[model samples]
Structures are given as structure tokens and as C-alpha cells.
Target: MTNYNELTVPEATLIQKQLRDNIKVTPYNGPLNYIAGADISFNKFSTTVYAGIVVLEFPSLKPVGYSLVKKEVLFPYVPGFLAFREVPALMDAWTQLPVKPDILVVDGHGIAHPRRMGIATHFGVLTQQPTIGSAKKKLFGNYEEPGPEKGNYSPLTDRQGELLGYALRSKNKVKPIFVSPGHLVDVPGSLDILLRCIKGYRLPEPTRLAHNAVNQFRLNEISEGWTSLL
Candidate 1:
């Protein structure tokens, strides 16, 4: 078990090193009948966090199961150690999921980080599930701009020229998203999944739905609390 509370930056870095070794980048030939997306959002002007998981039936991309959990922020926001700040709350929501997804898509980076371990990797390792990192921005690495067409991609490479992920064009004439294997999945698999999940949006359906879910939940909670106080 990994410690999730009261750790220094050095300790966190050490843990990341151990967790990075456990990540497996391979193709998942198993049936992906169900896919899920996990994401977290913070309350406005507060440290309270809402984590959400949205499951969608694969190929068809229909909604199946969803879960959300709220937690007081425990860890501070650190540049490379975002997992510590967010994963705990995400786990709270993940445990409430009734249907375990065949693969997970996280709204963050994977190996495309300074430490080769990101929030997506942490979630995948803890859950022991195949996970993909589909990030809105590039956290690290350099890559040429992908072609201005949906499904086109360019390799994202580290300073050492090792390929870490891809800059994927999910929509035509739009900025690309960064993608990498979190665990139990490879670059090719990641690309395939992302392209399938995209439905004419900058983000995939699973993640976009989850993002909406958590935000709506937060709004409802805050509104209800305010009304009760009136």
C-alpha cells in the first residue's frame, strides 16, 4: 500500500519512482465492452474537490454508470505531484462504481511528465486497470503539430528523443490533445481509444460527460446548502 497522507515532496518523488516501474505499456486485446472516464474538479474559492467517474458502453458510447465523491483537499497543489492532491478523492468515487470498466480514461498526463508518473498512472496502478491519459495540455515533451485533421497525430518525445506519447487531433482544425498510456495500454491502443471516444468535441465523450457530471453535482450541493441556510 502507498501512503496518501502527510508526505514531503521528496517522499512523494520516491513513491513516484516505485510506481513508475509498475506501469505496464502493452496492448489490451481483451473485450472493451465498457469504458470509463475519471476526473476531478475543485469548488470555487475553496479546497473542496469533487471527483467523478462516467462509464460508457464501448463503440456505442452510451452512458452506463456514474459515481461521484466529494472530499476536503488534503494535499497542496504541486507541479509534478498532482496525483497526491487528486487521486484520493478520485478513489472515493471510483469505489462507488457499480460496473468496473474494461479501460479507464483519465483527464491528465501519464508518462509525459518529469517523473514519468502522473495522476493517470497513479489511478491505473491503484485500481489495477488498463488506463489511458488524455490530457488537454502538454505537461512535458516536445512534438510537431499534428496535421489539421481529426485522427491525425504526431509523436510526443522526451528530451532524450524517446517517444512518450502523442499529440492527437481529436477534431478538425483544433488544437491537439496530449495522450499517453497510463498503464496496461500502449500508444497505439491509446490513440485508437481516443479517436473512438471523440464525438465532434475537443474532449472525448466519457471525460466530457464526467466533467459535466461533477460540475453539476458541485453546483447542486452548493445551491442546496445555500437554500437551507436562508
Candidate 2:
């Protein structure tokens, strides 16, 4: 495992470059038994981080299991280096999963980043798993606002005119969500899966469930652990 906190910005940037080569941007064609969402939460200026991963049954989107980890994160919340602060705890939760999901939906950017190494992309590379980034705001790239209808999307492109992801309206009249491929998946493929995971909300089921779960866990004062709902 990488010493996430011990590295300087330059070292982290280099690591990102090396890991970029490991990313295989292909269409998602794996098993559909399960899909997971990961999220991290903490109070303002607090080092106590709460990380959660919620696994749902494919197609049904029903929760089957979850893992939680609370740790003191020393890394500051840098806009681009969020994975350095969160992935360590997220991976701790990942290891405790009795059964791993076929894909992960992370609440951050993916390849749609300045260095092509967003939290989703970073985590996917570490685990060698297919992951998608479902962010609520734009981090990198430009696109026209999508139509104010469910499932409408506009192409997101970089300055070089290279396709990055899509700005999708998951629900009618709601703000668009940025969908991007993290690793082992392409731009369209990422959006395709996110469309299926939507449940009439701004955020998709997998990530929404996680976002809610982690916040609740923190509120309830839960500790680091894993639970099986299967």
C-alpha cells in the first residue's frame, strides 16, 4: 500500500502519472451481481474521518452489505488530493468486505481531472476494479448544461477536445451531475451504468445510499467496522 500521507505534492503527482498507465478505459462488461458506493465525511476542520462503503444488489439496488471506518486523517483536504486523505480508510473498509462488488461508484471526479487522477480514478487503480465517478459539481472539462429532463446529458470535453465524461441530468429540473470513468471503463460506459443506478434523485442509488449511510454513521457515533446485511 502507498504511504498516502508521507509523500509531498511532487511525489504524489509522480505517483499519479505512473498509475495513469495502469488504467484500462474499456466498456464495463463484467458480472452484475453487485455494485458498491463509497463516501467519506467529517466535521469542519476535524481530522476524524468517517468512511463508508455500501454494496447493493445489481438491478434491484437493494442494500446487501456495508463497511465503515473512522480514522484521524492527517492530510489536509486539498481539492485535487482528496484521495490521499480518504482512500486509506476506504481501502480499509474494502478489505473487510466479505464479498467485493463488481463495480464501485465513488462520489468524486475520475479521469475528468487535471492530472487524470481523481479520487475515483485513484482508488480504482489501487484496487484494479472498475469504478465510476459521480460528482455533484464540475472539477475539470467543459460542457453545455444538459436538458432539464431525466437522463439528458451533454458531452464533457477537455481543452484538447478529448472526451472526458458527461454532464447528466439524473432527474427532471435538477442540477446536472458529472459522470466520468475512473478506471477500467470508458466515458459512455460510465454514464450508461450511472443512468441505470438512478432512482429519481440528483445522485444515483449506489452513491446516494453511501452518502447517507456515512453521514448517519457519524451522527450515530459508530466506530470502524463492517456489517453484513446479506
Q: What is the lDDT of residue 226 in candidate 1?
A: 9
What's the TM-score of each model vs. the native?
Answer: 0.92, 0.96
| Residue ranges of candidate 2 with Cα displaced over 4 Å | 221-223
Model 1 Cα lDDT, one tens digit per residue, 62-153 = 87767877888767888888999889888877777766889989989987889889888888988898989989999999999999989899
lDDT minimum window of 10 residues, candidate 2: 221-230
Candidate 2, 130-204: lDDT as tens digits: 999999999889999988889999999999999999999999998999999999989989988889999988899
Off by over 4 Å in 1: 1-3, 221-230
Q: Evaluated with lDDT, which candidate comes out highest?
A: 2
lDDT of each: 0.85, 0.90
